[model samples]
Target chain A: MNLLRTAREMLEGTSYTLGIAGRTALALPQLWRRRRETTEQCYAASVKLIHVIVLVGAFAGMILSLQTGLALADFGQEGSIGSIVAAAMVREMGPFITAVILAAAVGSALAAELGTMKVSDEITALEVMSIDPVPFLVLPRVVALTIACPLLAIVANVVGIYGGSIVAESLLRVDPLAYRETVYDVLARPAELFPFPKDIYAGLFKATVYGFLIAVIGCSHGLRASNGALGVGEAARTAVRNSIILVLVMNFILTRVMYT
Target chain B: MSTAASDAGAAVRFESVEKQLGGKQILRGLSFEVPRGTSFVIMGPSGSGKSVTLKHIVGILAPDAGRVLVFGREPGQLSRSELASLRSRIGLLFQDGALINWMNLEDNVALPLREVQRLPEREVRPRVAEALERVHLADAAQKMPSEISGGMRKRAALARAIVSRPELLLYDEPDAGLDPATGGSINRLIRRVQRELGATGVIVTHSRSCALTVGDRIGIFEQGRMASEGTAEEMATSSDPRVRIYLGIDGEATTERSDSRGAEHGTGATGR
Candidate 1:
């Protein structure tokens, strides 16, 4: 019984969250009008998060490079470690870390802030003023995250790939020049539909999707909060948990669709 | 059976409106009318659905049955734009101020004008300044909500509510958490706004001072319905035992458990 109830609530929450996004799309014209607020949110989403992205990205690349190099070294193919690390970071880890950091850090804060506003009657106050919260509050946040996610993912890819190359050269005894040449060769592989390689474009696309999902989930949870402080706390927690789940699910689905 | 509209005619009319929230009936066949250009006070014990009624007037919450009419049109029947138009003509002061914490006092007050009125920036500033001056918060214009005192926050919210010069003003427990002096200042500001704007005011409050000082007609609510209504004089001299008991004028309920917190909208508060 409890499981069924929880499932029903999850479905309802997802439906409402998407409903908010749909409404936000209808209010897109207002985005240009409210560009100042959107720009501020973009700065907030990116600048506050750059440090975490760099730290996570660097560690992710270093680990992948070290593991791949040690295994390949047994076969006397350690020179190929740099290429594998580049492929993994560009196709997966870079976007993954970006999405995780955004969901855990920024999404939670958005949810908590909005949840506090809802419980305290500030949201109702906006409605009373004939101001739709969708246009005024949700749109800027969604736009900012959607735009920030891809750009930040690119930064992660660069830093992570560089970290991996360093690990390959120093830890695995692969020649530094050879490692760099192989990494470049992998990225230089012919592309079909985009300027960048399929892996690079696909990962950025995934990050963008994750960013949009995080903002919608966060805003929806916040708007639904009631009962006060405990409710606000729950909203923030749910935003992070649900965003990460959705990101992983989307990542798998996108990987299967694009690569296959 | 009782009516609460001022003698001038109904600006807002609730005809046997029934609303259920969280599986509990919060407003049970409730009915009342509020006339234009007068201060009407809805005084009730906590959880008596006073604030809910205020929300209904602005179309924030719709009744489950019956009708809620503002300006002879049902708020529930209006289109989104129409409802917004109606809401634009009204201003609401929330119980805890509800000022957006991110914005400074000036921006907060300027919201109605900037967002609703869509006025130019030049037009918004002077009106905001004027509203702040009225509430005696002119010096705190640049301060964020977190930087201000609770009383100042309430005053700033009031300024925001009136900056648009709305035709109808609603107050929900306008002095909920304030010192006596601050509450008194708020009460005085509320009266001044009503007198100066000639706007219809529906104030939902438990403060005896608020009801008596500002109300032209005072209605007492009991369990989602109006128990009685009259001038402050009539409320004080009321003959109905229920009215006297509720007003605590007759000292009847002091004998009971003393803490009869009525049902909350959700926390199992139901109409008797």
Candidate 2:
């Protein structure tokens, strides 16, 4: 009986979350009128997220360079570390690292804030005032994150590649100029469809999808919160957990679809 | 209210409205009518579905069975824009004030005017100031909700509710979590707003003091159903045990005194 009830609730929650996403898509037409709130949210979601992305991006690149460069050292080919780091950072690690930071920071914060508002009747207050919470509250958040995540991923890619270049020259005894040329080579290579390389486009596309999912999940869970503080805690926790899981799963699927 | 307004129709009507939450039936065939421009209070114990019924009128929740009509339009059946149009004519004061914590009192009160009416700042400023003045919170307009006391928050929420000059006002436990003195002030504010605006009021409270102080007519609810409803004088004489127990009507003398006291305040079951 408990399992059945749990399954039912899970299905209901998934459908509700999807409905929120669909509503967000439909609300795009109202974006111009609500530009001020969306701009404010953009500041909160993106400007506040830059430091975390930079720190994580740098460390992730340094680790990638050290591990892969040494492994190639056994075959006297550690010189290839530059291309490997650039490709990995652009295709997978850049979007992934940005998503991890965002899921933990912005996503959980959205859930907790909205959950508190739900418990306190603030959302209902908005509704009672004839303001739809979706267009009023959720749209700005979803749009802000969707726009910010991809741009922030570019920040992550640049910083990570530079961090990898430093590790390659200092730790692996590679020349700085040679490392730069190889890194530039990978970035310069073009894909089949677009003028840009597949790595850059794929990473950004992935970030956009991940960002949308995080905001949608966070807002959905928060809006459904009941039972007060405990329920709010659960919403925030679940939003982060679900966001991270979806990011990893989507990373693999997008890689296979775009690359293979 | 004019006789024509009364003859036109009730401001709100609940027809055999039933609702369930999490496997529990919160409202069971609840039925009532709130006359246009009268303060109608539904007094009941906790979990008696007073708040749930208020949400229905707001179109926040639809009844699983039956209907809720606001000014002759069924709220549950209205489309999103239509419901919002209906809701724009009403204002609700929640138990906890429900002020958007991030905004100052001025912006909070100014929200409906700016967001729904899209009024220009030149017009919104004075209207917001007037509402704060009406609630006697004009001095604290710049203060955040967290900076205010509980009573002040309720009053600030009242300012926000009335800034739009809504036609119907709903109060969900307007006196909860306050000392009697503060509660009395809130009760007075509700009566003042209802009378001054010529707006219909549907207040849900378990506080007998509130019911006696603000309600022109009162309904006593039990287990999601109406046990009794009448004016203060009629309720004072009601032999219904549920009404008797809930109102704490001890004897004929006490009931007479309570009714007269209620009348003196110009509201308490005066049947106005």
Candidate 3:
């Protein structure tokens, strides 16, 4: 009986998430009509998240480069650490870490904010005033996330690559110029399977998808929130948890699809 | 009976409306009407579905059966765009004020005018200022909702509700959770705003004082049904034991207890 109930809840949650995504898609035109609102949301989501993205990206890059360099040293291939770090960050880790940061920061904030509004009847008030909550609230957030995620991913890419280079030069005794040259060469090379370099388009695709998913999931939890303050807190926690899990799961899937 | 009178220029009418929420029947064949350009107050005990009834008028909660007519049109039958257009003509002041906490008082009041009505900033500014002034929150215009007193927040919400000068206004527990003086002032504000806009007004409240002060007509809800409805004088003079018990007019405490239970169980009408 417990298992059945859990299964039912999961199904309901998935449908609810899909419903929000569909509504957000339909409300996309409001991004133009309410450009100022969308712009403000975009600025808010991006500005607060940039620092986290850079800090996390740099550390992740350094750790990956140092560990991989040490492992490859046994094989006398430590000089190729730049190629591995650049490829991993660009194709996977950059977007994944950026998404995780955004999920914790922006996605949780969105859920808490909207959940408070829901419990307080502000969303109902909007509807009473003839403002569809989807167009007025969710559309701007979704559009902003979609726009901000890719830009943050780019920032992550730059920071991560630079961090990897610094670690390679300092720890692996690899030449800075040689590491830079190898990273550029590896990222610019065409894939044997795909038309474009695996890193560029694939990383961006993941970032955009992660951004869209975060917004939709956060908004869904928020809109369904009830009970009041405790409920709002729960919604925020759930949004962040779900966002992190989904981002990691999608990262693995996307990497496999793009690379293998 | 209310539905019959509804056609005589009623702004809102509910004919045998039923609603169930969270496995409980909240509005059980409920019926009421608010005549155009008049104030109708529905007073009830806690959990008696006053707010749910208010939601039905705006199409926020559709009736499970029967009809809810707003501006002589069935809200459930309208398309989304059509419903939005319909709602633009109505204003709602929710319980707890429902002001956007992130926005300052002035912007909160200006939102409906700018977003819903699509009014330009030049036009929105003056209207927002005037509404704030009327609510006597002009000094707190730049203050966020959390920065203000509860009474001030309620006033700010009132300002937002009236800023658009809607054709209809709905207030859900407008006087709830306030001291008598603050609740009295909010009630007076509701009356004044309704009169100024000539908007049909429907207020949900538990305060008999609020109902008597603001209602051109009053309905008493009990157990998901409107038990009695009349003008202030008529309701005050009502011989119905449930009405007397609710109004605190019955001197006998034992009778009050029995009547209260009956009202809760929806058996009071038969007992009377």
Candidate 4:
């Protein structure tokens, strides 16, 4: 009987602008704090993630050069290889690759740590102490990831450009100087290189939002998780799955809006 | 004794509280008073709403139909800073210890003092060391929560809770998972801390020993209200069958005892 009434109250709560405003008011500080904490955790989590990005970038650059070199060679347009690879990497590949890396690396960790805390009642302990877990746990990671994602995007660009250069010089037998000039010419336009920063910044913004979303969802779900190891596992899986989907959806929406 | 007077000027009150969740009335028109220096035990059967009662004291759950006061101000009436100030005076010992796995024992214990108190870095170490010593876990300060035993984790939690020298200590089933001997020791710690620090203690526990040892007064919760209230001796000798059953002692006459505690929530034995 009381549950029905409580549900009704919650429903009525959804009907009011004041209720929505109050909910937002209460949630904003928590969201801000969550962003800050997630940023901190993201720093530690991103170290290994950066290593993976480097390894993948190096190999990915090598593979792109090989395929593009072969294709251009067949068309007797081998010298156009550096420009083609540079356009693809700077325009799209760099940010896309970094986003995917963070979703797997830092996203998973946020889920697992928050899940463990939730199952173990650490989050409850915070509530009892009147500490906002959002600031203490979530915000650091958000801030850290926000900063780290852009830095990683920059790193991917450097490695990818170098990979394209290597393919142009070695696989196509083009001179290193010629390949460098072609790459520069292709990237010389402000539209090409200018968009890089926007893309990188947007990628970082997405990552920050992504980190915050994952941490909040993870912590919220975990804190509400049923008691047991299974609950923790479920929370982690859910956080990762949800974050990946959100990241992709956000990336699609944001890229179109920014570029268009 | 000195700080006790200061906190009396800052006591928390709850008036005619009622709370319902999911069609179930967890707390129904419950009212209570907690003064500055007395340890108050909230005793009840599994679903009698003891845990919900504690949540109200901390402002985690706003009462659906009544008022809850901390430092003479309603939790909702106070500004965020004022509420935080009130909260800083109260220390909570969670049932599962709730130690942060990413933090070492020392850092976990030192967290509030650093974040809320904002003590200098040099000053934090000694305060952390002293707090850990109070719980007899000074040497284990560098260990992770997983590295410690369940009992040690509880001790770490105690260290963290008391590190800031809070004026009020709240325990949610402080003795839930321990053996009888260990639970007794925990009870003694509760009493010892309350006595030494002169802090008001509110403990929710089914453990009779814990209540007897630590609480100066006991309040029995039943059917979502304060069913009965008395001293431990009065309760033990009362004619109330519910009180007798709560004491875990069988009585000699025709006493009506409801077995509702075991019916739902599995005795809430270890507490959520």
Compare candidates 3 and 4 on TM-score and give the better one. Answer: 3
Residues B1-272 of candidate 3: C-alpha lDDT, one tens digit per residue: 23345446679988998999989999899988888999888887878888888878888789889898987788788888878877877888888889988789999999898888789889999999999887777777999998876777888998998898888988888878887667766776677777777889998877776776677787889989999998766776689887776665533322322222112113211111
What DockQ values do the models have?
Answer: 0.78, 0.74, 0.76, 0.58
DockQ metric, candidate 4: 0.58
The TM-score that candidate 2 achieves is 0.91
lDDT string, candidate 2, B1-272, tens digits = 13244336999999998999989999999999998999888987889998889989988889999888888887888887878888888999999999999899999999999999999999999999999987778888999999988888998999999999998999999988988667767787777778889999999987777777678898988888887899866776689888877777655423322333223233221211
TM-score of chain B of each: 0.86, 0.89, 0.86, 0.86
In candidate 3, which residue ranges exceed 4 Å CA deviation? A191-197, B1-8, B249-272
lDDT by residue (tens digit), candidate 4, A17-108: 23323343355555643554554565675676777888777667767777888888888877877777676666566666776677667666
The numbered model that scores best in lDDT is: 2
DockQ of 2: 0.74
Q: Using DockQ as the measure, what is the rank order of every candidate, best first? A: 1, 3, 2, 4
**Candidate 1 per-residue lDDT over residues A145-193, each given as its tens digit:** 9999999999899989888988887878789888888888887775677
Off by over 4 Å in 2: A1-4, B1-7, B63-67, B236-241, B249-272
When sorted by TM-score, best at the front, the candidate numbers are 1, 2, 3, 4
Q: Runs in model 1 with CA error above 4 Å? A: B1-8, B239-241, B245-272
Q: Where does candidate 4 stray beyond 4 Å?
A: A1-43, A164-178, A191-231, A257-260, B1-13, B250-272
lDDT of each: 0.85, 0.87, 0.83, 0.71
Can you write out model 2's per-residue Cα lDDT over A1-260, one digit (the tens) per residue? 99999999989999999999999899889999889888998898888889888989999999999999999999999888889999999988998888888889999999999999999999989988887788888999999999989988999999999999899889899988988888989888998987887778888999999899899999999999988999999999999998898888888898889989
